[model samples]
Target chain A: MDIAIIFDNIGIYLEGLQTTAWLVSLSLLLGLVLAIPLAVLRTAKSYAVQAPIRAYIYFFRGTPLLVQMFIVYYGFGQFEVIKTSFVWPLFREAWFCALFTFTLNTGAYTTEILRGAIEATPHGEIEAAKAAGMSRLLMLRRIVLPSAFRRALPQYSNEIIFMLHGSSLASVITLVDITGAARIINSRFYSPYEAFLTAAVFYMTLTFMIVFLVKQLEKRWFAHLQPQKTS
Target chain B: MINLHGYGPSILEGTFLTIAVSLAALALSMLLGILGALGKLSGSLSLRLAAQTYTTIIRGIPDLVLMLLVFFGGQVFINQVAPLLGYEDYIDINPFIAGVSTIGFIFGAYMTETFRGAILAVPRGQIEAAYAYGMRRDQMFRRILMPQMIRHAIPGFGNNWLVLVKTTALVSIIGLDDMVRKASLAAGATRLPFTFYLVVAFNYLVITSISVYLLRWLETRYSAGVIRA
Candidate 1:
């Protein structure tokens, strides 16, 4: 039990923790940004407009992230044209490759969640907004998106936690995140238990915090949905 | 440009291993699911706490971390125990067992929630009716509860199984010769990661789509009695 090594190496682990946080935050922000338009396209009335987005979502959601990462990192490198393209700079680095894959993967799941929330928005609300002479864009900005966001908060939080968990896969692609750090330390010390247990503890604490915050948000947003206590 | 001319045999072998791993893990997950669900629903406080703790901890941790921990830590633990138990040779855990057990352990947490929810959704009236007819507890569970719970659980179980199938890809990191690992090797050897991974993705889609249809058929069969004439 190399317990002392873990305790003394808190500073080293903190750097890994910071990398993990950055990876999760960047991927989630990008994923959410990409998801909105995709979700809107999914709900579009025309089959021609909807088909590509549907395929994107199905491909991303259907496959594992590890495979996706390998394809993006190694697959793109196989193309001489891609290497010479303007986009090669972004795809050249492991971190960017990871970020790109995570964003796309979470984008698929988030699109589904946001689409469900948007569709679930009451028809009456939109009718009222239109009757009030609101423009289509204004109606979307003022009425549709706000309500959809509120409705989607709980499930979106689950997506966030899942993305955080999924980001651990990036370690396999050579990104030095939390799991990667554990692997490096485990190799150095030949002590898998201590290194992995520390990483597990870090993940659990983050998950607990996310769940707690999401619960608080749910209470604030859905207070009206709670049943009244009888005297 | 990408080519996949020479990767057929290796990819096929890997696909077989992936299927075997997924099926083994699925079986183990179902067993754990039933047991964990029963533990949560049991009268004993200790059993309930144990189940809750297992699910919560597994759910909270990342699957990759858990997989690595179990794979490497398991080897270490086994070697230590082997020496203590009078075994002289250091026994290494096989990658397949490690992969399946890790996936099973992680997904067993998910399956517990799915199965437990399905069980609770079974009506109280049905159980009471069974009791009224003087059915023993075992008889009631086997004949009355299990069948109905499976009916309600098939959809959720199907989703979990699909995800588990995809998750077998993670075992590749631990040197398992599953499809993803084989694809990785093929990509390295052939310099055609794109073609091979796209093939792998399509393969997953085919399997998941077939299973989705099968689950739908099972759902329809189970609900036949309740369908309106």
Candidate 2:
């Protein structure tokens, strides 16, 4: 009911918003860049090539994001070797640990999504690519990957939103994302509704924005499959 | 199994508690889902809108945020309303109850969508045929609709269950003595965070793997009479 307190802390929320935006966007971008190759290898003919990737995906998908984050953030520091390693500097920071976990988590999911799309590439399309006498790499880069990306669009959008929401967990590690910002305000004023509700509103707005953008992308990407507009 | 240093029994108890929480929440979610599905598919416009708003808000917000909101906000709201009802004793909202309700309430929105789609998937002609045979509404729903909806619902329901199992970890933040909290406590005491958390992660993996195997078997059982291209 006390809305004025939220307005007074708007600057803190904005800072939190910035942290969330960058965390989600950077991880998503890096995850996608990493996933494309892993997905290709996932659909390979050899079981040896596929088994490791499958294990990676299963581990990430099976565990909770919070547990994964903790494993990276708090768990890794338990080892003397990791503590002595050069990567210790980065591993010690909560922000790096969160981003690293989110990237791997999203990467595993995107790999699976893209693997399905790749496997589902129409029979005739591959035949046509083969007929063109293109190299295996050429056929994949030009034919399989583009269409698979299109097919993966809807699911990718959902993943993006999931990551956005998942980013809220960063608050638990002491990074002041939107949820962290709300927790701060709540402790200060003991006004849970004003604090968390404001955070919820921010999240909802961001979610709708992502949904809108994805809808536009879908429309453009699927234009060829859409019915013809006749005069 | 990593040496637990005497925390094994506590972790085992926490595992059971986690399972209990998820199952309780699952039952609550299923009830709300059926009602919300019926509400969304009902003739009343207000009912449909209410169902829509429920799903939308739940889908948008993070589960942790919602958990905090309900835990803290519910405490303040209940104490304020207690005076009017002649209950003067201070009631601290139990974290277990708060966690269960928040998770159940959130997943209910997902289940609503699943159940709604499942209901729609049941053939219209079959319903009409049941009507023609002069069956009562309740009888027709039981005999004709329920079976078909279950077949369609299994996949979505399975996905929801897997996610819900993992989501029980959030209850630990609300101070519910779940496995995650137990592991963290053991980790702190032993100063071996990796060993404990890795065990916790494997615990989750085992649960999900078993659930997947069972879900596949259920899917096959339900689709026994049907053929796919």
Candidate 3:
């Protein structure tokens, strides 16, 4: 129908795309940084070490991201202590609230994913590390974590995509991400097809890009598992 | 102890509606999944390609954009068609229906993959054996394929169900009075958004935890005779 409207509003969509890219990448980067140590703790032998980490993961994984975002965006302002705190201004901004929530949310999911990968490590590898008399920290750094990261790559790609999609919720809180841009265009022009469909195309392109990148990573990462090619 | 400020019952009602919406969407998704799976597995080229496109596009788009599209775009599309059919009044698509259909349609793609794999997992020899015994297609499917497919499908189906339940929260954006919306309403009135949203989160945790437990039991029940590594 009104396809020209989308072309005319290309600048707005570019801004929205930048916002989305920043939100997703920052949250994903921060989430991975948060997940690594927490996942290590999660696979620990002691129940005491695992309990709090379990609860954090459970809460984040169980609840919807939208609710979590709302809790941070709208919920935090309800507390006087937060209002008086040094980071109160960050909490007041919609962007920070979204980023904060996405990081914690993705962090929980990533921690679980990494924990599974770590636990699924071959038994003999750990035994070999112990036989070589390597310290726990050394063994983990040199062996367990690297393999786990590789094993976690496929699942982590899925998490990254989910985070990208989840970032669309930032639109709900008045941030002009792709969905927000589409919403603005739709409301202004009453052209939902032109607006939201364009948004969908952007999302689809990003999803395929992630999928392609992950495939390339897997081929490189899992080369050892592949059979040798005949010359 | 947390104070609800007498909005506990309202939240409970919202929880029930959330459950209702999820179940409705689940039923719709399963139906579409079965059909899509059958289409994917069908002999016709058009059917296979159609199924492939459906799942691919749905997987690529975010649920919220699709929800907004179907809710807002569906309204526009309906009125545009209605005029040609001699309808004079504007027809507003119900948010509940729009939300449910959009979610169902989206998850159907996922279910298509799950069900197709589950169906493929059913040993081909068993189906051939049934055919050799002079069993009809429907009978063979009901007696052999269904049981094994269910067993194989439980794990994936459970994961999809959990995600679907949580996705129902998006209905609030379209003005459905689900628990999230109810919590926000209560928060607005009392100016204690933290308490209300925390309660909503707790509610979701309860639902998902219970579902997880039940799904585990279902998996065990379905896997009763099967040996595992």
Candidate 4:
């Protein structure tokens, strides 16, 4: 019940909060960027074109992100080839390890989510665009990607929330995220309830905020799906 | 080539423990899921509110935070209560129990949603027919609803199961000596994190593959007559 420790060490918790925010957002942004083209390939009719991305998704989704993080962070360091390479320094930092793994993991989920959305697009819309003289790239840019993204928004928000929670795993690698701050507090004061509960409060607040923002975005972007008003 | 430097058996033992915890947690969550779903679907306002609060809070918090909080904080909470009950010694929360309960509680919230959806997916006419036959609630549930709900729930339940298996890795964080912890121990001794984690990853892949195969078969078996567009 001694809440003063949390208040006194508020700055450390804030630093952790900042790190978690950065981790989730950066990975989500990178994942979204990569998911677009990968999802396009995913919906292709050809197996050869789609197989590799499917394998990538299957591997990432099948395993735990903790193990994946270890494979990248600890696995890469075990190799002298990687250690002597240009990206060795990056592999050596916990933050980079977290970023690399989080990006790949989120990319896999987003690719799948967006692929489902893209595949659900009506065939007539594409045919209509084709008949109107829209080229493949132009039609994808104008009609397909936008609608798929909008349709994917709800699922994507869930994935985003998952990433936010997943970022807590960064603390395992000694990156000072929110969970790291809580661990620090717990060790210093032996008050797990106060330390961890404070971090939980921060997480719950963020989750609700993200949910609210996504709801607003969905209303704005999905208004076209709403019924026409009788004036 | 498997070179664990004499730690393979430990990893195997860890794998068994992983299965143990996953099964235990799965059972606990299913019970909680059914109860929570029933609560949410019931007519009582308090029941619905309680179920909703449980799902919302569990879904919002990180699983790792909850694990730490329950394992460590549960200890403190128990000690605080023990003095009033005339208990003199500190009670340690078993990591297995802690891991299972925490994962079960977290996934219960998720399973509640899936079970609720499945319950709702049961055809209305069938229920009305059962009611007209003067069947009791329990009888109607067993004879009319359970089979159909299971069929409808398989897809979502399959998904939840896969995620649940993967999430068991977190139990290692709380000192459960699960596969991940065993791999890390082996890696620490041999300084070959690559090999151990690769094995762990392969182990997980095998489990997921088997789960996928079995779930697909179950889906096909249950959906014998249902037509798909």
Task: Select the stronger candidate by lDDT from 3 and 4.
Answer: 3
What are the models' TM-scores?
0.97, 0.98, 0.98, 0.97
Flag regions of model 2 displaced more than 4 Å.
none
How many clashes in each structure? 0, 0, 0, 0
Q: In model 2, which residue pairs have backbone atoms overlapping below 3 Å?
A: none
lDDT string for model 3 (B54-143, tens) is 999998999999999999999999999999999999898999999999999999999999999999999999999999999999999999
The local lDDT score (0 to 100) that residue A114 gets in candidate 2 is: 99
TM-score of chain B of each: 0.96, 0.98, 0.98, 0.97
Better of 2 and 4 by TM-score: 2
RMSD of 2: 1.1
For this target, which candidate reaches the highest DockQ against the unseen true structure?
A: 3
TM-score of the A chain in candidate 2: the value is 0.98
Which residue pairs collide in model 3, if any? Answer: none
Evaluated against the true structure, the overall lDDT of model 1 is 0.91
The positional error of residue B227 in candidate 1, measured at the CA in angstroms, is 3.5
**Chain A only: TM-score per candidate:** 0.95, 0.98, 0.97, 0.97
The predicted structure with the larger lDDT, 2 or 4, is 2
Tens-place lDDT per residue, model 2, A117-213, is: 9999999999999999999999999999999999999899999999999999999999999999999999999999999999999999999999999
lDDT of 3 at B170: 100
